[model samples]
Structures are given as C-alpha cells and as structure tokens.
Target: MKKTRIVILGAGYGGLMTVTRLQKQLNSDEAEIVIINKNEYHYETTWLHEASAGTLHHDRVRYDVTKVLNRNKVQFIQGEVLEVKAKENKVVLKDQEVSFDYLVIALGANAETFGIKGLDKYGYAITNVNAARRIREHIEYQFATYHTEEEKKDGRLTIVVAGAGFTGIEFLGELTNRIPELCKDYDIDQSKVRIVCVEASPAILPQFDRELVDYAVSLLESRGVEFHVGTAVQEAREDCVFIGKRGETPKELKANTLIWSAGVRGNAVIDNSGFENMRGRVKVNLDLRMPAFNNIFVIGDCSMIINEETNRPYPPTAQIAMQQGEVCARNIAKLIQGKTNLENFVFDDKGTVCSLGEDDAIGIVYGKKIKGTAASVMKKVVDDRALFMIGGTSLLLKKGKFNFF
Candidate 1:
C-alpha cells in the first residue's frame, strides 16, 4: 500500500505547532510529513514591533526552522507557495508542484490597507522580518539625512502611525522608547520629534477596559506620543498623511514616515485556492476542517471560528492558532490510526497581556487586571512561553526574554 503523505503550508505558529506535535507522535510507517515555507527562519509575528522600532534586533525575533524540526520525521521545503489546487490535492510552487494526501493551510496574513489611497506606495507596514528591518532602517535614514539637508523639513521628524489597535499601540510603545536613543545618536533636538497615533475607533485598544486604555494613553502621552482617537486616515501622500473625522474633510499631518498597523487579512492563497473565505479566512468546522473538505485543515489567521459568547468571530491570534494546532495534530493522528479521535479546537482563554515597550504593560489574567511592572513581567513570560512551547528549555534559554528587572 502507498504511504499517506501530509503537506503543511507555512511555518507560522499554527503550522509549526502542528508539525511539532505530529513529529513526536507519528512514525515513518504511518505517514510522511512535509512542511513548506518561504523562509528557513520562523520569526515571532508578535515581536515585529520591537524590530520595526530598532529596539530589538531582527535576529532575536526569529530562529532557524531546522533547529526545532526533526529532519528524519519531517521534510522542510523552503519555497514560495504560488497556489493550492484543492481539487487536485496539489500545491503549486515556483519550481515544482507537490501532491499530498492531506493539507494543512496556515499561510498567515497580509497587511490590510482598507483601500486607502497612497497607502500602498507611501505607508510602511511592519508585517514581516524584512518589512520590520526596512522600517527601522528607513526611520534611521530619515534622522541621519535630517542633518545633511540645507533646509530641514520638520515633517521629517514627525512620525505618524495609523491605527491604535494592538499592532499600532505596541509599535508606538517601542517607537517612543527608541526615539530618545535615536535623537541622541543623530544629534537631533528631542523636542522637535513628534510621534502621533491615529485610530478610527472611539478609543485605542477598544477591547481593553476603559481604565487600561486610559492608563496606556496617559503613559504614552507622557513619553511624547500623541493620540488622535476617534479619527481615521483619509489618505497617505508621499510626504504626509491626511486625517480627519469620518465623512469629513481631511487635514494633512505632514510626516515623512507613516506606518499602517490597522489590520490584516489572511493569506491571499486561501481565496485563490477556491475556498469560501471572508477576508481570506475560511470559516472552519469544530474540528478545524473546511466544511467541504475534511482532508484540508486551516489554522492561524487563515481560519475563522465563532465566539459563542459574542456571537461573532474570534480575533485571529497566535494564542488561538497554537491551540488549534495541538488539536489538528491529534485529528491527523487519529486518521493515521484508522480511528475517529478528532478533537474540537477550543480557545482556553488563559488571558491576554499587551506590552508597552520592554518595561511596561497591561494585562488581564484569571479575571484580574494588572498594570505597570507586574503586567510587563507577565508580557515577557507570555512571550517566552511561545519559545519554550516550540523548542523546549535550550531554545527558551537561547531566545527567551530573561530581563524581568
């Protein structure tokens, strides 16, 4: 009999976790496992802000995939996935096509521009390792070029961040911390630099309680961060951004650097593959399988599940993706064993902790709200936990955040 071949796409949290669990449980006699990703390194999408702001080196946020993956149990392919032909059970890559008995799609998300004019050309988004590095270098370039200009434009020092959501708010936190270091290094007047955050929502971090939002706002404001809540980015021009109240005339905020952190949609491959998706995310069954296709499992930002309490879709998060991955591995194992041991994917709701730079944060755990240093510690612990979960103690000691002081 021919051996079953399982192909997993992308190496994000969900895909990696699924592979990690499956590798440990399965033997060569059962199935052959393959993981395809664009890069050999797996970077923490959650820590991109630090890299984008130059607070953390890009290397610190990513790791070589080979270190955690067992080559004997799993084959890792470094290739750009062009498309997935679900009907054919094949994934088309740039150089070759591979057929599989089962497919796991965890291709991740892309920056959502929301059809705003000029954003695609003018705005910067810290979506990946390269993007983060580019943003950091671009910001520094602007600071360095400021001194060389015969007529310095104040706008060069004005950095405007679009959105006050998770990515936006966290980026601002790191940027604020990074700005002082930049100003000194470049010999630029600290008072001349302006860091502004614009959000369309009524408040920043709307999911957080009002008290935490207020505290975060106040903390950032003291560090020279400006908040323009209840506003939207109308357009992004080459040297500035136009912002105003909804349905009103836009006013220009002259700034050379405009970073968009508003939202993200799932990988475009999802829609291209003919899966029924909203914003590139498929609404999956309780077992994390596409309704029409049981052999294909979707996870991470590419999969959607409803929150029974809210009667709406749960936000795509790393925490949720890893959980789905654990369940996904079990179901795949059951299939291999010729037993129906499929498990329903569940969001455990351990809690949430949002970092405010490296030293400050806010969180809710077990129904208890925390702030300041305590919250900061929790944030680091959460970040470290991800590394520990993937590669164990050695990897954790190598990449974990140990500065709790």
Candidate 2:
C-alpha cells in the first residue's frame, strides 16, 4: 500500500514548524512528506528590519532550510510555487507539478501596496533577504553620493518610512542607530540627516497602550526621528513622498529613500487557486483546514482567524503562525491514523515585544507591561525561543541573539 503523501509549501516559521513537528510525531511508513520553498534557506522574518537598516548582516538573518529537516522523513524541494490546483490535488511549480494526499499552504505574504501610486516603482520594502540587502545598499549609495557630487542633494540624506507600526518602528530604531555610524563613515554632520515616520493611524503602535506608545515615541524623538501621526502617504516618487493629514493638502517630503512597511497581504497563490480570501488570506476552519476541504490546511499569513473578544482578525504574526503549525501537525497525524476527531487550534497569547534598536524595547508580556533594557532582554529571549522550537538547541546557538546586555 502506498503511504499518504503530504506536501508542505514554504519554509517560513509556520511551514518549518509544521514539518519539524510532523517528522517527530509520525513514522516513515505513515506518510511521505515533501517541503517546497523558493529559496534554499529560511530567514527570520522578524529580523528583516535590522538587516534592511544595516545593523544586522543579511547573511545572519537566514539559514539553510535543509539544516533543520530530518532527511529520513522529509524531502526538500526548491522551486517557486506557481499555483495550487485544489480540485486535482496538485501544485504547479515552475518546473513540475506535484500531487499530494494532504496539502498545507503556508506560502507567506506579499507587500501590500493598497493601490498607492508609484509605490511599486519608488518605495523599498523589507520583504526578504534580498530586499533587505537592497535597501541597505541603496541607503549607503545615497549617503556616499551625497558628498561626491558637485550639487549635494539634501534629499539623499532624508529617509521617510511609511508606517509607524511594529516593522516601521523597529526599522526606524535600527536606522537611528545605523545613521550615526553612516555619518561617521561618510564624514557628514549627523544633524543634516533626517529619519521620519508616517503613520495613517492616529498613534504609533496602536495595539500597545498609550504609555508604551509614548515611551517609544519619546525615545525615538531624542534620536532626531520625526513622527507624522494621523497622516497618510498619498503617493511615492523616485525622489520624494507625498503625505498629508485628512482634509489638508498633501505635502511633499523630499527623500531619496522611501521604505514602505505599511502593510502586507497573503501570497497571491492563495487567490490564484480560487480560494475565497480577504487580501489573499483564507478563513480556515477551527481545525486549521481550509473550509471546503478537510485534507487541505492553511496557516501563517495565508490564513485568518477572528479574535472573539475584539471581533477582529488576529494580526498575522510569527507567534500565532508557529502555534498554528503545532496544531496543524497534530491534526494531520490524526487524519493519517484514520481518526475523525482533530484538534482545534487555540492560540495561546504569549504576548508581544517591539524592539527599539538593539538595547531598547517595549512589550506586554504575560499581562505585564515592560520597557527599556528589561524589555530588550525579553525580545531576545523570544527570538531564541522561536529558534529553539523549530531546530532545538544547536540552531538556537548557531543563530540566537545571545547579547542581552
């Protein structure tokens, strides 16, 4: 008898966690597992901001995907996923099509532009390792060119970040730290450099309480960071951004570097596959399976679950995705065992931490609010814990953030 073939897509936190758990829970004869990813490695999506800001090297952000997989139980495939043929139970890749008895869609997300004009052409997004490296390189080029040209463009020194959300704020934090080094390296006056954050929301980090938000704003302000809260980015250009408050004329913020961290939608493959989605995210059943099919599951950014208390969809987060993966693995195992009952996914709210540079942060952990160095330490611990969960002690030590001080 042929074993059940399980196909998992993407090597992100969700997909990796699912595969790692499945390898341990099921025997070789029970299922044949195959994982596909566009790249041969998995990068910590949380660390992309640091890499984009040049504080952390891009190489340090990613690791070989095969390193964590048990070769005996899993086969790794490197290819871009084109689409999913749900009816046929086959996935179309660039090179070939693979059929599966069970399918897990965890293909992650795309940078959401929200119909903003010129953003696709003008703005840089910290989406992946290559994108992060591009932003770092582009920023350095602007700074390096600032002095050498006969007509110095002050716009080159101005950096506008489109969003004051978690990614935007964390990037601003790292950018502030990196600016000093850049000024020193380029022999430019630090005062001439500008770091501005534009948020559509009335306040920065809207999820955090007022106190934590205030602390974050004040700390960043001391470093010459400008906040334009209750403002929207109307448009992006090659050398400037148009932003404005409601009922006011949009003003141009002249800056060669426009980093967009405003929002993200789920992968296009989800929509292409004809699944009903909101911004490419499917609303899965409580068991984490796609509503129309029990053998198909969707997790991570590709799946959306409502927070009953707030009546809002829970933010697509690494913490939630990893939790979904744990539950997904168990459900798949039960199905393979010919069991009717499957475990329902209940998110254990661990908490949230938003970093401010390498040494500062703010968070609500276990219902307690924290900030400064203490919060920063907790941030590193959270990062390390993620590494531990997927690859255990060795992967943690190899890529963990050990510097709490």
Candidate 3:
C-alpha cells in the first residue's frame, strides 16, 4: 500500500500553515508530507518593511523551518524550485526532481515593476530578507559616504520612494524614525535629508477610508516625509527618478536611493509551469484548488480569490494567506479520504492595520477605526497572533514583538 505523497513548495506563511495543519490532520501511515523551500528558515513577510528600513534585524524576522515541522511525518527539502510539470505530476528542482500525489504551490511573489524602465536595474526592492538586508546596508553606505567626499552630495541623503501603497508607507514610517538616528550618527543635519513618497494614484492608500488616509498623510508629513500624490514615476536611473504629473513633462528628482514598493506579482514559476494566470497568480476555485487541476492547490500570493461584494480580487495579505492554508489542508485531507465534499474557503473580514514606526499606526479593526498608540498596540498584537497561529505560544514568545510603549 503506497501512502499518498503530499508535496508543498516554498516555506512561506501559506506553505507553513498548510504543512502545520496537514501534519495534525493526517497520520504518518496515511500520507508522506514533503516541504521544499529555497532557504532553511521562514521569515515573517509582514515584518519585511522593518527589516528593509534597518529598524528590525533580518534574522529577527526568520526562524528555523524544521523547528515547527513534525519530523516523523514531514520531510524538509532545501532546494530552488525550477518549475512544476503539472501534466507529469513532478516538480523540477535545481539538483533533483520529486513526484507527488498532491501538490500545493505557495511559492510567494516577485516585485512587479509594472513596465517601468531602469527600475529592475537601479531601484531597490524589499522582496526578501536578503533584499531587505541589501537595502539597509545600501542606505547606510550612502549615509556613511556623505561626509567622506569633500563636495557634499545632498542627493545621497535623498531617498525617493516609488508607490505610496501599504509597503511604501510602512517603510517610510520606519525610515522617518531611522533617518534622525542616521543623521546624528553621520553628523549631518536632519533637515538635509529628504524622504519623498511618489504615488501615481490621486490619493494615498486609496482602498483605505479617507479619514484614516488623511491622518496617515498628516502624521508622515510632520515627520519630514513628502507626499507627491498624483505624480507618476516616468523612469528610474542610477542616480535619480523622473516624475511626471498629468499633462506635464517628466521632472528629474536627483536621489541616489530609490526604493520601489510599487507592487508584487506572483512567482514567475506559475507562468513557466503553464498555469493559466494573471500577473503570475492563479485564480483558484472556491475550495482553493486550481480551476483546471484538482490535485494541485494554490495558496498565498500565488493564488487569487475574487471578492463577490466588490467584484475585484482580494489583495494578497498574510491574513488571507493563513486562512487559505487552513482550508487547503482540509480539502486535501478530504480528497485523500475519497470524499467528494470539500470545504470552501471564505475570508473573514478582520479589518486592516497599517503601522507607522514603533508607537504610531492607523487601522480599522472589527469595524472601528483606530490610530496612534492604540492602533500601534493592535499592530503588534496582530504580528504576534500570526506567530501564534503557525508555531503556537512557544514560537510567539521566542520571536514576538513585545515593545509596546
């Protein structure tokens, strides 16, 4: 009797959640579970902005993936996934290939440059832990080099952030807190440093309530953050960004540091693997399985679920990914049992919270709007809750954000 082999790709939030739940749902004799990840650890994707801004250490966002797995039932494979041959039911990795009875694609996403020129070459993206570390070190290097030159280049201190989305805003919040410290360290006037956010949209945080958006904008403005709403980034260069407004010529903004937080598309492997997708995201069925293939399930950023109310796709968030993982595990278990009925995944609207530095934030939680320290506290609670969900109280206590002052 051959046990059903379940293979999960990438050890991100979705992948970990599915594996953690599946380990409990199925016995060792029933199914052989395998999880493949490029890295040996899993990092909190939500805390990436903090890591990119140098407010949080890169290692703090990650933990050993094997620590959370049940070794008796789960096998951890460390390798880069090249592609999934869906038709053949085999996954091609850099060094080896593996076949599975069930496949779960949770490969995460890549930075979406959105056809912007030179951004792929010059602009820094906060995609992963390594990318975050590189951005932090690059920013620090720019600050360190400011005084070394006899001719002071103020452009070195000017950081132009592309996109005023959640990531862009959160990163700016951390950068605002970090810049003052950096200026003090480098013996440079804080006023000389400019933190500008360029948004193509007419307003910042367009999906959020207007009042909360206004509050966020006001708070960031007070912290020396410049908001260039309705301005589009025309091009990115090695030393500057060109911006243009409606019916206006592109104006060059001289800044050595350009951090692009515009958007992210699902992993390219989706397209390469021949999955019918938009921006690399597969529109999975209500049960979280691929519409075309029942054996293959897609979760996290790699999967898209449409909102019936708004008739638009739900924004890929950590909250939704975790929820999808739970449902995916149950569905897979049902299939293995030769059951026709599978549970449908529905997202519970828990509201959203956007953090601004350590003690400032804004959000709508449980239908009520919150801001300042209260919202900030809720943000930390949210962060801790995610850890608790995947790894329980022990993991939460080990890697939780306890500083709520």
Using all chains and alpha carbons, the TM-scores for the candidates as numbered come to: 0.98, 0.98, 0.98
- Scored by Cα lDDT, where does model 1 land? 0.91
Against the true structure, candidate 1 reaches a TM-score of 0.98
lDDT, residue 148, candidate 1: 90
Count of clashes in candidate 1: 0
Clashing pairs in 2: none
Encode model 2's per-residue lDDT on 218-298: one tens digit a residue: 999999999998999999988888999998999988888899999999999998889999999999999999999878999
Higher-scoring candidate on lDDT, 1 or 3:
3
**Which ranges of candidate 1 are over 4 A from the true structure?**
150-152, 403-405
Candidate 3 wrongly placed segments (more than 4 Å): 150-152, 403-405
lDDT of 1 by residue, 287-365 (tens): 9999998899999999999999999999989999999989999999999889886888888988888888979998888
Which of the numbered candidates is closest to the native, going by highest lDDT? Answer: 2
Worst 10 residues of 1 by lDDT: 146-155
